[model samples]
Target: MTIAAAAPVMLCAWLPTAPGAATATAALAGVAALALALWQMLRRLGVPDPDRAAALILLLPSVALNGVIGAHDTLWAAILLLALVAALDRRHDAMLGWAGLAIGLNPQAGLTAPLFVALLINRRVPLLRWPIAPLAAAAALLGTGSVGWTIGLRPLLHEAITGHLLAIDAPNIWTIVQTLPLGYPLLGLAIAIAIGTIATVIAHFAARPIGDHDMIAAALLCTMLAAGLLPLMHERAFFLADILSLALALVRRDRAHWRIALLVQAGSTLALLGHASGIDALTILGGGMTIAATALLAGPLLRPAANDNPVIARSA
Candidate 1:
């Protein structure tokens, strides 16, 4: 969390442009805030030596990658994970509020909102607490950004609000639809695939609270696959989705999900290699399908296990 939030700030100090500097600085501040939140959460959880070790092992590579590649959106991604960790453990309503605000600040963090709502179907949180943190976070980001870029900030922020959906890097079913001409035969098939994936996620969330995490994990994975399996996806969009899948696997302590997660990770790694080594499309798509199938299958299998085992909830 600290690394994801901090590295960008560190990088901005050396960059030459003003807009880049402002963006980087805001990201840094957001990351720093997230780090503090994570620390407070760890303390609340009674941070053990093992927890610290595990966090370090997991986060170091993440931080390094974001820093090296200058992946700006990752700071918000870390915030979403921290919120998930807190929420999964049944933490206070304050954490959910923070997660929501983080979502408003960066739409990528919106993933936490649906996950939390799914959690709320079976869990309890005060309603008032729901709006405060998100409102405050939105106010802060907008107020701060306005100080730097005045006249047209509203329009710019509005663009930023929905930017995640518009970005070509979105690895969802639309990617495939985007590949086809408006009336192409594959367009209908792509729509069906998207509806099915979304319906599966919703059904899983609706059926059992035990599978909330798995639902979120599967949704993200499917979104990524739907994004990448499309003929048009670039490689980098798979990165954060893959990370979230791995984390979900760890949280569930399910080997099957882990295997699926690894397959996706391996596919991403191979895709990166393909980009670097100029590998053939046949090989790339073949590997991608394997990864996509494994990830896509993981949710249903793991979700059912959670519903079947009441003992798992007690342990968590």
Candidate 2:
């Protein structure tokens, strides 16, 4: 099984069954993973105890809501963070492996794979080592019985194409379009174009050899892009961006990162409330904050550091 999916399954196998036992167990596991990931990420970024504590405090709500109550997100978030930590340590193979396991858990996790590959290639890792990622992903999928010839590509394609075609309650440009009589397919196309354009620009500028900080920045950008651009995304998707941005903020000592993280947290919380209450207004406001935060974050994240040389930064 994909490690994310396997986690709960293994818990069930070993633990006694009771009302809410599974959820409680899953929540415990999620909380543990999140705490470890957060601690490791902070240490890697050289964050001081006070800053680390602040970051953790900022993430606590998300950990409770998404990580504990909504356990599906926990494993993927942990895997993603671990992958980022591996990347920061220059452990290319481990990064790729963790990323692959993430993708196997949730196809959406693949959104960051291209950026990871690009960064690795820019680092001049051997071409031969690159295939490890896709191979690991495939292996995880097969091991999980999530893919087979009879099952084929049809189910996967259908899920990808139709799963989140509508904005539903997500906060993004698509939510605005959903009310304007636009077709869902057309809206999807528009989002695709927008993401493509933004990604192209990021790729152009990100061609330089990247540093650990830059990789973290790239990950933050990718998470924001996915949360903003993807159709049918729920509030939980922002958890990744929120936590990653907090990490970046601690590393860079930039208030902008913290601001964006708070914006995302606020938006996500509102979206969840709206979803539970069936309140359109709350969802709308939440989405607006999310979009604004993403736009604000993109400006500083895309620019090169003013004092550092790209080559020197990369080699460091």
Candidate 3:
């Protein structure tokens, strides 16, 4: 297990030896980190009403499940990545540290770190720092020196390839996928995710020399697409996407963004409800809302922008 998951176990050293006490402590820490990260990212994005906007994420069922109701490390993993994004915006040296920690916590962050690095690299932070995340992930995931490669990321990769289910109340495209052989649906899901990811990258780079707001918007879109496309997903998979919707709304402070945020929160909540109650109707509706939210999330990036690529970026 990664440090994030092992935290509650380790907390036994400082707190009561009971599993419940340690778990509560760890969950509290994750919630606190999440709260602070939401505020800092919103402030850095220049949200005029950070307090009010921060409250919006609390309404997301995924966030509530991961941060309060469960002792899940996914919340901490996401906050660390959010901190890394904030560090890049501030041109701080802590970017690598945060990236390393986030990726260490959740190997999934390894997929998103490089893009953030590419966005903010200049003479200030430079391009050299961009390679560390992948290298660290490779060493942990592929290197023979470690056991993590065998038991950790390997299982995740296996699941991604041969999904255990069509959809676990995730309310995504796969939810609509008819019951078929695992190979066929997993193959289709992979292709769809690849195409969506490519489009997301295009949308991101089209706003190249991307601004902080642009980054937030792109993160919102990308996370939504991931939640909506990936197979074998659960309601909690929308955790980051649901939270980023609020962050994007705050950054834009507009009707459309707010609408999407509200829709995403509601959809994720419904998905969670369906998961708990075994109601396919609720999940189907939630999936529809999720898909709509993702489509709207990409709208802004689809718009025209000035010089996405600066052939000769300004000197620091």
Candidate 4:
């Protein structure tokens, strides 16, 4: 509850006179911020068509669904992008500060924060007192527990996993499985967590220097795995994953990669618009589209980067 509403509430605080105004502001600000970040990141990566590529986010159907339809989830993507930029610049304090806020923003993004922090620590960021990165980094932990305390852990856990949707409207493994003759919601949830875990482990080992494709690809895997499979998810679930996929595509500057980004996002759109318009076929087809598109994406992206650190590289 805290994670999901943190961004919206913060925005509302600024526009205290009218929450409607805040929602309007959040929608525009989140996508605008994300687009700018993508543009800058592309310029840094030396993509020839950075301008064209960065504008891609503006055209995604899911953007209209979430941003125009009053969903605040885009803020999660924006904050992570800011935090990633900070990490790339070695501004560890800023990174932690954004990361902490991200942990308080969305569960999929928050779930990836610990893994990101763990990878940062593994990179020998040295908790030495020269910079207060550790102190700054504690932001991820500090304010994140308030919601759990308020709601009680058991209820929170139930809300997160067990007590939620058995038939998610979005695509991925669970949607595919649950739509079968006999749905296994618990089993599907277990498999989703396992997929996310595998992605997390791969990301832990594949931690490249901040600027490399490995870093973004690894991060993409961490978030996409969960957004794709977890039970509390819906059409908007793939929001971060869609952004990351496009980012990875832009970083690589491959036409095929761009197509991959387009397709997965198209799937998200299918589910979103379908549900909104009451088109069940589009939703189901969107699920299949998501499954097919992500399958093509995950296989290539999930490969471990060549060893740069023995501690992470070695199998235990």
Best lDDT among the predictions, by candidate number: 2
| TM-score per candidate | 0.59, 0.80, 0.74, 0.74
Best by TM-score: 2
RMSD of each: 6.6, 4.9, 6.0, 6.5
Q: List the residue pairs that clash in candidate 1.
A: 101-134, 171-227, 172-226, 172-227
Candidate 1 vs candidate 3, TM-score winner: 3
| Local distance difference test values of all predictions, in order | 0.49, 0.65, 0.60, 0.61
Error of 3 at 70 (Å): 1.8
| Per-residue lDDT of model 2, residues 1-316, tens digit only | 1344235423432454463765576566655565567667777666778334543633456666764454455655667778877887878888888888767655656656657866675677888888887787677567546312122233446755776445667766666666666444665476676578556745644476666666676777777777677666654556676677667676667677778777877887777778678897887888888888878866755555633544225532
Span of 10 residues, lowest total lDDT, candidate 3: 307-316
lDDT for each residue of candidate 3 in 1-316, tens digit (9 for 90 to 100)? 1234334322422453366665666566665556657776776666777777766655656766764555344443544545445553664445564565456555555444435544554324566766665564454344322322132355456766675576777877677663335445364655677566755665445344655666666666656665576566666667666667777777777898889988888888888888788888788888888888878776656545444322212211
> Which residue pairs show collisions in model 2?
171-287
TM-score: model 2 vs. ground truth: 0.80
**Model 4 TM:** 0.74
| Model 1 lDDT, full chain set | 0.49
Per-residue lDDT, model 1, residue 27, is 50
Q: Judging by lDDT, tell me the better candidate of 3 and 4.
A: 4
lDDT of 1 by residue, 208-237 (tens): 555334444644544454444333344444
Range of the 10 consecutive residues with the lowest summed lDDT in candidate 1: 164-173
